[model samples]
Target: MSTSDPRPALFDQWLPAEYRRRGDFTVLVVLVGIDTRSIELLSSTFMNVIGDETRWREVRQLFQSSETDWNGAAFFPVDSVIGPVPNDMARTQLRALEEKVRADRRVLNGGHFFDRKGRRLKVEEIVH
Candidate 1:
């Protein structure tokens, strides 16, 4: 593959992987200019990036129950640091992430979604 190959380059940061723990809605991690579908593709790479069958299995379970494209929320390691990212921090992280990745050239991208009503997002808004 070339420099522009669609595959996500080896991830440098071991930021926590996570999944939705409650309602049907999901939060996504993505970049502004990139296509959402392309960002969604990273779900398949989580297992490889995670590099552990047991770990992926646990993370997989979090998403499998939802009507997700595996793109609903973040993916965390099953054994440690594997759970929901606090919504406030998640939003803050995304705010500066674009610039952070550009300076560092990391393939990091995703969205932290919420509802239009200024409240936390619900399942309907997330899955549909």
Candidate 2:
């Protein structure tokens, strides 16, 4: 949250309660360029960072889904302040991201959410 953008931190705050107490993390990666915009989600495997893998598995079993996990999540592609950006621009943006990642940048990290039982989840929730 040190950067000018606060969307990522906000997303981390809005995750379900189940994931938070356990320290699970989620993040979204968006490619923004001249004509293409694509979304790539990243997250830690539930068992990788969670201290209690057994308990985590049990909760997953009980919920039959991650619908109840409260892990802190974040958004990416800090640019592209709007929706459905052009695909070419997105591609360009992605290329830029690739370069940054290659340079060891901290651009992409964390886990993402998915639609389950009628709930729709996005990798990064864009905030303007």
> All candidates' lDDT scores?
0.32, 0.34
lDDT tens readout by residue for model 1, 1-128: 24653423322112222222231222334312223322322222122222222333444364555444433333222222534355555555444553454554223322222111112211221244
List the candidate 1 regions with Cα displacement exceeding 4 Å: 1-54, 71-87, 95-106, 109-128
Model 2 / residue 122 / CA error / Å: 20
Predicted structure 2, TM vs. truth: 0.29
RMSD per candidate (Å) reads 14.0, 15.5
Error of 2 at 66 (Å): 17
Error of 2 at 92 (Å): 1.1
Candidate 2 Cα misplacement greater than 4 A, ranges: 1-74, 78-82, 108-128
Q: Model 1 compared with the native: what TM-score?
A: 0.27
